[model samples]
Target: MSAPTSNIADFLRWLETERGLSFAGYPELWRWSTEDLPGFWSAVWGYYGLHHVSDHDEVLADATMPGATWFTGARLNFARQCLAHTTDARPALIAVSETGDPVETSWDRLNEEVAGVAASLREMGVGPGDCVAGYLPNIPQAVVALLATAAVGATWTVCSPDFGTPSVLARLRQARPTVLVAADGYRYAGKEHDRRPHIAEIMDGLPTVRHLVSVDRLYASGAAPDQLPRPDVTRHDWTELADRRARPVFADVPFDHPLWILWSSGTTGVPKGIVHGHGGIVVELLKALGLGVDLRADDRYFFHTSTSWMVWNLMVAGLLHGSTLVLYDGSPTHPDVNGVWRIAERTGATTVGVGAAYLMAAEKDGATPAAERDLTAVRSILQTGSAMPDSTWDWARDRLGPDARLQSICGGTDICSVLAGGSPLLPVRTGRLSGPALGVALASWDAEGRPCVGEQGELVVTAPLPSMPLYFVDDPGRERYTRSYFDVYPGVWRHGDWVTVDADLSVAVAGRSDSTLNRMGVRMGSADLYAVVEGLPRIADSLVIGAELPDGRYYMPLFVVPEEGEPFDDALREEIVGAIRQSLSPRHVPDAVVPVEAVPRTLTGKKLEVPVKRILQGARVSDVSAEGAVTHPDMLAWFARFAARLGSGRS
Candidate 1:
């Protein structure tokens, strides 16, 4: 609950003693972050060894809402910083699957491939400011295409391979990319599903696409033109394109220039395109790597994620610090449930990142990796995508190792960086993010816009920080960006997270403010109940929502997915009620405990509590058009029947 100390001081000492990193103006760097944030960010651009073609005299001249600018007259290349270490001897990428097969690509080889693709793009008349989209998985080739697009100043957009053809078309149609990269098929859970048909359907929807390049993931003999949905769409092989190549050149642009376009999970509506700049992203991520997680040069970083998640973009910052990144493409549990742990052990990963839901799933399966693997090399374990339950923290301490640090981090795609997270200097509390990030003036304000301690409220930032999205692609003059985060507080940024900061300054994330339920008059976050219910041994995961009765009264309805063989009997329900009543108030207790086979989640592994609540109200869920809505839609029908039985008082 004390004020945060200077993180720059700690970063400097760690850099000198532990990381062996040297830089000029160490003291000035500390002052700029705290006193002059604009100067601090400007210094980061130079300190991190970024490539810039132009320089500016003014670091920052405005601090207004939705109009702030950094390094006003500077120009830089995003792809150059990413490919700074390009060489024949250094390994640029190391991709491995759950089956223990490894694929390696050197920096020089990757650069050569990128050059070939860039030359081909020029031949097809794809120039700067054009959009190039990728409907692919997390592979080396995807990274190559992205870099190639950025090298030529073309915007890069991507979606995971799991998305259906309609969903892919909906996004691509909005962005209208000229070139599309896809695969014939991908392997998952030991099955090869053909994506050629899906790709063909996508190309049919995108009439602007001039070229469709397919990677032979299945290793087939020849390309079939009849298999493609659009016969007019020209096809190119991945290897053949690499064979005819040229040297890639970096394009320089303004510091605030657009680099890439990322889409928000269209859970509520059509996904919005978020555009970020090169200088801001590079500097902000470098600060996050050095001061946020305290990443070291020799460290090996691994996160279980797809190309769709922002974590993939965040993890690329590790390369700036000279760390080896371990990429995993297949399911975390392929042939067996222990696949991720096995990879961690073999790779000697120092930092391991996993979604909170995955950790709970492992606990549900009674998975204990302590006896099966050696996790001594792991220094910190990062958990995000949702709030970390208290039971998961206990499992990490007891099962993973006693000495390991469990850091529960919280941030969203809007900023592409964390507003508050774990710090090495801070103590790891039971189920709380360690503390506020350096230079991030984060606070918890109530509905009345009053800052209060020991009270749950909306999380907001008092000042502008680096890495704020430059613009929304569809919005003209930045109207949507202003309405999304800045409209709530005028000048301050209101992050859509419901959280509580204790008197001690320790942070606890409740849930998304947009998803918080109001029962009668009291506001309750979904995470408030999830933390309490997940603490029980009988429950693997639980979703809590407020359901309206015919009499105009609202009651909390709980749906639980029990561990392997556990049932939702009367005794187990009583135990769950007792725990909630003891930890929170009596109002937190659920009116019913309905057992389910699986809880619904988005592609990023976040729970869909609001959509589930709608189903219980006798509302039609099929009318809903949210991106990544319930992976299994049938589960909602089961919940509806259970709700009907509960309403009849038949239990």
Candidate 2:
């Protein structure tokens, strides 16, 4: 087999031969990449052979934050780059489900299906600047639809079938897609869920959608929905688009043209639609997946994720390396704790990525994956979404063998790539990430915006990156985009995570500095909870928080103040959980609900979510907030006492 094209060692050697550049180690190389931004990015483009149809006159046209211009005068398409690595030796996509037979799609067949869908989309008047939405699961059809949308120079966005109608509409309404690709139903945890009613409601809400392409996944099992309730919209079957005879054609769009949209909500209730460009993603993925994770052409990569999470998008990028993608569309712990391990072993996955919580849960469940399952093909394990304890890492390393490289990464949906993550040259450390990613000027800053080391501080990036958002949809004058990252540090990207950078360059992420609730790798805004809970007539107000404990466990609790003449009881708790599960998602349902005399709030009437979360995580009241700044100052003591009762175990 041929060697990988973009690993760290290969890049270093190629740098020496092509540019006469030499560095001692990862740190020196990272410094050069950040300091000489233009030279480094230009080298990446050339090293990856990303110049598809045209050449760029300049690498970095502008270096400003929230408006960085890269690779001007270049023309390329992300789908074209992905298709360039196709080979006849291996399958391009391997789809596995809990109760269904595994299906494999070859490179040639994948190309044909993508071309057919692209042709159909063009015939529907979909072109550049148009949006195509997907309401599907993590299946091969979803992958083909996204690639086809890119092939036609259209922006793609998707939400998993598990999401409720309200949550799905909250995002799709903003994009205003002209075409929607949906699945009639999906199977999860050995059960079939018919989503036709939900899709019909979503379609009713999205008036801009003129076309609906349905993938009948449940038809084989005789559980498909009989008919969709919508008759005004044009309908097409999945087979029609996939079987149409057509040749592959790619649009030569500009470098910064919008490729896809990913949603990341903040303190505000609305979800922000972050748009990434074609050129930025092509180069960034090659660096992040190839160098950071050390992915090779012959390797099989598997990451268990829903279509809603950004990791699903990253997993799709594995095709750029000609690597086989192993996709699972079901619950991770359906039959047993060893489900993920069994899939990895069966698929011969070289790189396995999952949230840290899943491994911790497996360990707690007394699962011996390495002894029971043949995971010898797994060369690396990538973890993200939360901090992993030292004991969890020790347990995983011992069970998986010393040869396995365990990496705890820290990045977000905003960029759809790694900021501080794995490197081939760095050593694995317990409770810490390997280091900052190359081309990312990452640092920990104190309250005064000064760089700090050996102590926890705000995570900030001092330089611009290629994969940053091109713009947020509907964000006129870049107002929302600027206010999201630049308002905190002015010209620097504040990632909202508290981190520590040791002298050796290894980094540790504590948790989110802001009020976002991240439960099992799925991040939801606190405002999303408020929108559901506060709407109830029996609830006067509510505050919800997701806290990561030191023992690798997450505790999410909802505190509510009952309305006048209303009492909080078992019935109310059930109501709250049902509302959250049915409206937002089953993932965001709080672990516990408690009745409170009053909800804590700041003087500005904003809910004190971050302070309450910090208190629950064992911080002092004074350390978290000032008494003068809060409406109910004594509520801090109440939360502190509550933390004391739970103790370190967070029971």
Candidate 3:
């Protein structure tokens, strides 16, 4: 009906004329990319005009997972690429929160600050291969610290300040960082929280920390604003480093050297520590930002996330493409559900990003963004962290208005990039991802490991991608690394997500594969039930589990948390059941509709379905639940008592 509008059309034309590519359109180019792996990635590095100190001897040396090496003999510094293209005083970073006005820093200023921070880190005796950890909010200081660590060729790890002492110690201790960076405190939801006590507990648990650098946010100037109990470790103030204005030193390292560490949510046990490299991240983000999101060099990029989320790390990579970043630290709903929308309008963000849950909440609040805010410059809105309901897509259309495309991306900490997401040349279908990311080798495999199209199965990457974790921290002998991905399908990387790919290449992701509900030999995702139940006005949240008994019988119970003082009657239950049966299938309906106080969820908003299912199927709660992993660990007690009573009753 209309011509296709793409931000990357000019780039594609350049590839055709300059690179001598014969591909005509997006489909042909996509096929060429997935088929000729080396050519596709090499074209990306070249097209992005990335600077390197030395040329790569080979594009891909070995094509093996956990063993694949990319850009052999290439020597480059990540921070250098991030700062290479920008030369003017234009804003490179805009930091905002719920409390104050947005702070803008120019590209030149960011370069100088990063150089000074890197110099400060060197003065602390940090060198190549050393580890630096950030226990801070999603502020500019966190980004500066990460870039400084990368500039020094040291590994960086981060956790949000919102985490409790146990959560902080459980993750940072495994990295064994010799240096730690944190803020004195942060403001959230009309309250101020001091991190001094939490840092004391964390430092006591981590004996390996030699240097502790504190960012003075809550207290701007003072020698004793926040004192640490661990007097043995050297402490440096963030303001002091800026005052010195020392020059930064860049390190030239191998392609596969560790750049940062991202942890699993650790709900079941100690979070799985994943280590990613510089070259892999640089190349991967170049493709993801350039082609997948079609992000421009001058565009303002914003993603609402804490430092704890993997998306925060990805947002920092916006610098790699010279995209100005708009960093927000406070709660997304601090003043109201419209906080993020205001930031997008104020920043003139070409692309805005947020978790799927945030959009759902705003839509539920009856937010009309275009009417309430100035969104003239907004072109696209990216949502990830989970599959979005169809209602989210409809709401974004009405709220953001025309020219703002809703991109529902699906990827996680495992790959550090998207598996299925936005495509400029493709149509954005409601409740469906645009398509597979270029060069992802993405496919859906059935139970017997056969690749299937138009059928639901486990999402697996059959080939190696640059951004996959090289290995896990403290996982010597590659035992955990191999078992986490490869053990499921030998060489193929089973990403643990259940997805369906249509014949036209569009993808619809189900929930986690391990948490899929099977009803009388029929398999369905738990997300499907949530898409039906949570849309109701009376229901606040829902959790469903198909527990298998020792006698091979399934107990399909649908648990719902009703709104405050809202009644849950048989009429409402039947309405929910009828909706599921009509939209999905008769087999998809739950056997029982049970009311609960609250459904258990992880701190990151993920339902603890698999772990809760494990607990219901005769496993101990201690083995299935972690203290720091859950949002409401107290809520788990209700589930445990309910599971015990299930022994005497039937759903």
Candidate 4:
């Protein structure tokens, strides 16, 4: 994988001449990341066609988290921009369920529905700064209600319907939402799961909620009743709330006004409430769509994500780009294993984004979409949330048509857009993220805070980007936000990704900074362990964690999921350990090899290592049980038993 000699300037020129993009599209974007960032970002707000009431003369009033005022004088409604180019007939949302009939909402109809919902909220005493909590699926109702909340100047927070009652209560308690929107039930894997009971439990726990609005999709007859009550709960049907009202106008607010409160998946501790601002989020989303993904108005954008993942927020940006958003609310491989590819073929999705885990699953299942379906409409496939293996790229090219671009995108919820990804103008590399986003100053720095190439180091952004989180909710003086990113490197945002920039300037991801195991004072990323062990035909997936023995020595424990029906024998374990020892170092060899059925993962499909470490330590693990454990829960039990055996010197 060779790095293009073309810098941001050359890339922009190629975009203009070869890609046929306008030269004036995003000059500030190219200049700010390399030159004056503040000016570049200030220009981005106007270049992206954002709607603001007043022209902001100042780019940033302060640099501190709590004191930062972006577009201080500017006043605009976030919902207005989302609804700006919408038409009456254009499909705003196309929602398909797992087992039931599909539903569609036109742009004008969606706008009207949002207005009615907003009117209902206003009538229910909901006001600005009030939180509107949603415990629903990725249905059209959720989208409409979220937009309505933004239109009414209320902050919105949502969790997927799959979340357990305790997780929902924890998030709603933190946000203290006044209005709670839920569904009667949802379908997953051809089974209808009743959410009414979960909703009741959540309402009982949250005394702050004043209105409980329920979408009637779960009713046996699909009838929209006025209200349903059980004990202290009274639910208002979503359809009944939709009454023709005068086109509800949007409320103008400052650019830094809070739009939504998103939570960090609580795999270790309580979920942190990260608040995002209007101007920064809007500009960042537009840049990601127009510049990063090169989304066009006529293209149909599809992503396999729930409301829980950050990709959902990024995918919603396509609506702002005037592209039809094709949303599927079910298992990626449900009804049949080919559900996602079938959806792509049916929708003619030009740009499709999916988590890397799904690609691995496709490889395992021997799924080939290009041979079975017409994928010519697909332009690029954006993959993130986990490191994509080289094999996944080969499978994509071989199975998903040669013309399609395979973009290895890497970013987090903290930034809202990818820091490193592929550009359409560049040639596709095997496993590396083609390059950094135009305005992102992404580089690898060593432990001594010196920039280094061809070696693994911390991934840091030297300059500020608009989409960075403004502040955490209720964090007095922004202490936590500062400590999270800026505490490690003064004045620099250290994204906790261990990466190596090769001599060719191609970046290869190691793993999370926190999860990097230190054995005998040598830092080893877990991805290195997986790359070595999982490459063997006997292994399916594995989780490597550094465990402290009772003797106070830290040792690496490897839990592997073997290929089905393959016996996990001592001979195979020796081979796995030998592979790790030879590929990495002798210290990289696992102290104990435990074969497990599955690995625990967060909602975003990231391995939950911290909590697994806690369970190994024999501490009462509560956080693991809080959020709906997506992976097989028995893996924790297997880990506990394995750890006990290792503790007793039985390995």
lDDT of 4: 0.76
How many backbone clashes can be found in candidate 3? Answer: 0
Assess candidate 2 and give its TM-score to the true structure. Answer: 0.81
What lDDT score is found at residue 37 in candidate 1? 67
Question: What Cα-based lDDT does every candidate model obtain?
Answer: 0.75, 0.84, 0.84, 0.76
lDDT by residue (tens digit), candidate 1, 1-651: 973433455556645565454445423333345466664565555556552545776677676657678777777766777777674364667788755566667778877888888788778777777988998787777888887787787888888878777667667888888899887766777777777777777888899898888788775732367766566678888777766659778777777777778778765456778888877777777787777787766667887788888888777667667666777778878766667777788777778888888787777677887677899888778888988778778987888877667878887788788777877656789889877776566789987789969878899987676578888878997888898897778888899888898766678888888667665567777887888888787788777777675546676778888878987788988988899889988877777777878887767877767666666665555544353333765776676676576567663
TM-scores of the models, in the order given: 0.89, 0.81, 0.96, 0.91
* Cα lDDT over the full model 1: 0.75
Clashing pairs in 4: none
CA error at residue 74 for candidate 1, angstroms: 1.4
Q: Mind giving the per-residue lDDT tens digits that candidate 3 earns over 1-651?
A: 884445468668768787888666666777778788888888887877653356787888888776788889888877877877558556889998777788998888888888998988887888787899999998999998898899899999998988777878889888999998878788887788887777777778889998888787787742253546667888888877755677657888888888999999877777889999888898898888788898877789999888888889888899887889999878777677888888888778888999888888788778888999899888778998777789878989988878788898988898788888978888999999988988898899998999889999999988889999989999999999999898879988999999998888899998998888998778898878888888888788889998896566688888888888988888888888988898889999988888988877776778899878877787777777766667777767777777777865743
Model 1 steric clash pairs: 1-504, 1-505, 266-627
Summed backbone clashes in each candidate are 3, 0, 0, 0
Please tell me which model should have the higher lDDT, number 2 or number 3. 2
Residue 250 of model 3 has an lDDT of 88
**Candidate 2 lDDT score relative to the true structure:** 0.84
Candidate 4 stretches greater than 4 Å from native: 1-32, 51-53, 64-67, 100-102, 220-234, 502-505, 548-550, 581-587, 623-630, 648-651
Candidate with better TM-score, 1 vs 4: 4
- Number of residue pairs clashing in candidate 2, backbone atoms closer than 3 angstroms, sequence gap of 3 or more or interchain: 0
